[model samples]
Target: MTSYNASLRARLMPIGLLLIAMSCIQGGASLATSLFPAVGPATATSLRLIMAALILWAIFRPWRWRVARRDWRDLLLYGIAMGSMNFLLYQAINHIPLGIAVALEFTGPLGVALWSSKSRFDLLWIAIAIAGLAVLLGLDHGNSDHTINLTGVLCALGAGGCWAAYILFGQRAGEVNGMQSAVWGITIAAVVIAPIGLVNAAPAITESHVLLIALCVALLSTALPYTLEMVALPRLPTQTFGTLMSLEPAFGALSGLLFLGQALSLLQWLAIMAVVTASIGTTVTGRSAEPIEAPYPD
Candidate 1:
């Protein structure tokens, strides 16, 4: 088996990286909502990616390392995608409830899964999930602001598309130069977001508590989680990783409930269940005729 596939097998095991990814995501959401209230999503996101990149750069010292110029270009694109995703998703969360924002964001990958599938059964699962989303979103027509923010929903969708790109480019970066590529990729992403954060959140930096909260958000969301994901990604199949990632919305919802006191109505709870069930069903029973390839930052 290919090294990547072998790694996938290991990570796909129930007690492996899958659990770590979920944990990281859960921790990240809780941290973002509670600690970084003063900072906008973009600022919080930029701080985390920048701090995480700094840590990884210190560990890898990728600067002294050399790569082909072409590879560097790929890493740059990867960083852009990553930065965009962070900014957009955080922005989405600012306007919409965490659960709804996450669910909408997931549509990007869900669309990719549907488009890339060769199996009819995959189509069925994707259709069911999309229909469920439609039903859930229908509740927003004349409801509380928490129901949904159309603008935020669109932003979440944008972030999801960027996430798909990040995965695609990231895979290439990983393939070309192994972990070194991730080090550089995240650095580039951090640099890209730095200016945006400065412009949007520099004032808040003077606030002692805001700085502290930003650091906390950075550590839980970007620093630790990215490290764990990098360690895990190499070991899991692309399809399995995608399927496993379908849990992010559910995890986000749970985290919000636990930490932020975000409550869900019966319909919202049912929508969450529909997504969780469809995701698990697809992952457990759906067999891929060909390996699933995802896009990432290069």
Candidate 2:
């Protein structure tokens, strides 16, 4: 009985970690939205990256790991991609609800998954995803509130593109030490966003309460979730991991509702469910597929 329990725990541990990571990530996003009025979205994003980079550097000591010249290019691209993705996401949520923003942003990985696969079944999933997107975008005429901002949708799409780039670059970066690569990559991101954030929202960012909240966001959104994912990735089956991660839209919606008091219409909820289902279907059918690479602090 003892041995059986041990085995069961081992199997369940990764699932638990992934679930926790998803919750923390979405929760952090919702929390960051609350900070936007004070620090602005760009500054909040900068603070999160800066704090996360500091924490990861202290914990991982990535400087101790030597990188090859070729690896530097990969890391640089990875950082840029990650920074752009987060910045764009922050900009997006400023204009749209968290759930809608996340659903649209997920198109990046969904596109990548479909592109990488040659299977005919992938087309079916893609079609379903498109239908969902149409509904989400109010193209289906189901939305009474046609107040969705075009710029916000574009920003989310841009973030999705950045996310795709992050995934591509991360595959190469992962060839190095995982924790080290993450630390250095985030540091580079912090550097990239610092000037804009500091220039626009310096006073707010320097406030004691803002700094404290930023620290909490860094831990919840970046350090903790990333660490849990790193631990869980190797243990979980690729399909299982992909399916679980696809639930991020639902989690995002939940976080938005719980933390920000954001509500979604019935059609909007169904649209989110459709996209998630398509993602899961794509993942399950894709050949020997790795899970969608969650772009930093997802």
**Highest-scoring model, lDDT:** 2
Summarize candidate 1's per-residue lDDT along 92-175 as a digit string, tens digits: 877767777777777666665555555557866776687668656765357564356687878878988987777667767766
RMSD for all candidates, in order, please.
4.9, 1.6
* Model 2 lDDT tens row, 1-298: 9999999999999999999999999999988987899989999999999999999888888878899998999999989888999999999999999999999999988888888876779879988999999988989894467667988899998998988888888878878877777788899999998777878675676788999999999999999998898899889877798889789888998889889988998888999999999988888888734444543446
**Model 2 spans > 4 angstroms off:** 142-144, 288-296
| lDDT of candidate 2 at residue 89, scale 0 to 100 | 94
Candidate 1 stretches with Cα past 4 Å from truth are 1-17, 139-146, 200-202, 230-240, 281-298
* Consecutive 10-residue window with the lowest summed lDDT within model 1: 289-298
**What count of clashes does model 2 give?**
0
Error of 1 at 233 (Å): 4.6
